[model samples]
Target: MSRARSVRSPRPLLGAATVVAAVATAGSLFLSLGLGLTPCRLCWYQRILMYPLVVVVGVAAIEERSGVARTVLPLSVFGLALAAYHSWLQVTQTTCSVGVVSCATVQYRLFGLLTIPNLSLLAFLLVTGIVAVASWRTRR
Candidate 1:
């Protein structure tokens, strides 16, 4: 009997994270600048957390860094939490009076369910998963 060994690389995962973050960032920018949609406070916060991942993850992927998760995981996790909270606010119809644009307002939806926050949540989730897998692969 012959035994085969499998090797996994973290670069691809990091690359994927970079792409996800880039797409999310572009989408947000397009919404705000191109479509003239005003972002709520929560949306701004989510952008703050997500915009940097494109550069961070891209660099890590290009360099094939082994310890990128240590830096990225915190941001990814926080973004995920914020996105979840924003989505919950929309779902529960909680009114936010902090900014001109209400956090709970659904400006647009992809399929009637995928609002901006939902998309952000999905992107953060994807980045979190990618970072986790990359970190784990490095450990092996």
Candidate 2:
């Protein structure tokens, strides 16, 4: 009789999530600083939720700490929700008048469809899913 064991490392999964967050953070900064795109209220909220994730998630991945799930999940989930709402506002042409620029204003779009909020939504979803899987693997 032979016994078989499956070995899985959560570090890779967390690392992927860290990369996602880092890219998203950099992209957002580039859009604002490089391109001079003004961030709306919702965009600012999403940024607030996402920016810290780079440090938090990156540290967790580097330290190989699965406990990061507790922090990452909440922030990512909130960011996802904000991004979704922002996307909806843009799609519906509803302007959220909170800052200098309207939230519904689409400064630019990729492929004439993908907006900034869309990218934010995707990034949050990826980080959320990856961190969740890493946490699950750690538990199992």
Candidate 3:
């Protein structure tokens, strides 16, 4: 008599990142479209960095490819930096010497503390953390 061995595959990190990215994307979209909020230049830059992540991670997850996680690090790092800078701009307000839709504009605030850029910063940090964890685990 022979016993069959069951195989267990590790969870794909990309899937986890993809789920988070999806939620982030949807949330931002809702805030902009549903709430009729205009995104400033900084906000648009953050969106540019985040929007592709949703598709990239989602595809990698569907294909069960871990390489993408490692590859996405640069983007995540830059995104984190941009989000941080954008958040700082809102806090400092620097007189916003520019015209309309200045980067320092904070359209709405959650709990009177978390501005849109602050939320973006949080989201980028989350993505960066998740991607780093996934990459580290994949190597181990």
Which candidate number has the best TM-score? Answer: 1
Instruction: Provide the lDDT at 69 for model 2.
Output: 93
Better of 1 and 3 by TM-score: 1
Off by over 4 Å in 2: 1-6
Q: Which segments of candidate 3 are over 4 A away from where they belong?
A: 1-12, 97-99
Give the number of the best model, judged by lDDT: 1
lDDT of each: 0.91, 0.90, 0.75
Model 3 over residues 1-140: C-alpha lDDT tens digits? 22221111113566677777787788889998999987777777778889899888777667656567666778778888998988888788765644458888778888988988888888788878877776565556
TM-score of 3: 0.84
The C-alpha TM-scores of every prediction are 0.93, 0.92, 0.84
lDDT of 1: 0.91
- Clash number by candidate, in order: 0, 0, 0
Consecutive 10-residue window with the lowest summed lDDT within model 2: 1-10
Residues 1-140 of candidate 1 have per-residue lDDT tens digits of 22222245667788899999999999999999999999999999999999999999999999888588988999999999999999999999868896999999999998776999999999999999989998888788
Write one digit per residue (lDDT tens) for candidate 2, span 19-73: 9999999999999999999888889999999999999988998888888999999
- Give RMSD (Å) of candidate 1 vs. truth: 3.1
* TM-score of candidate 1 versus the correct structure, residues matched by position: 0.93
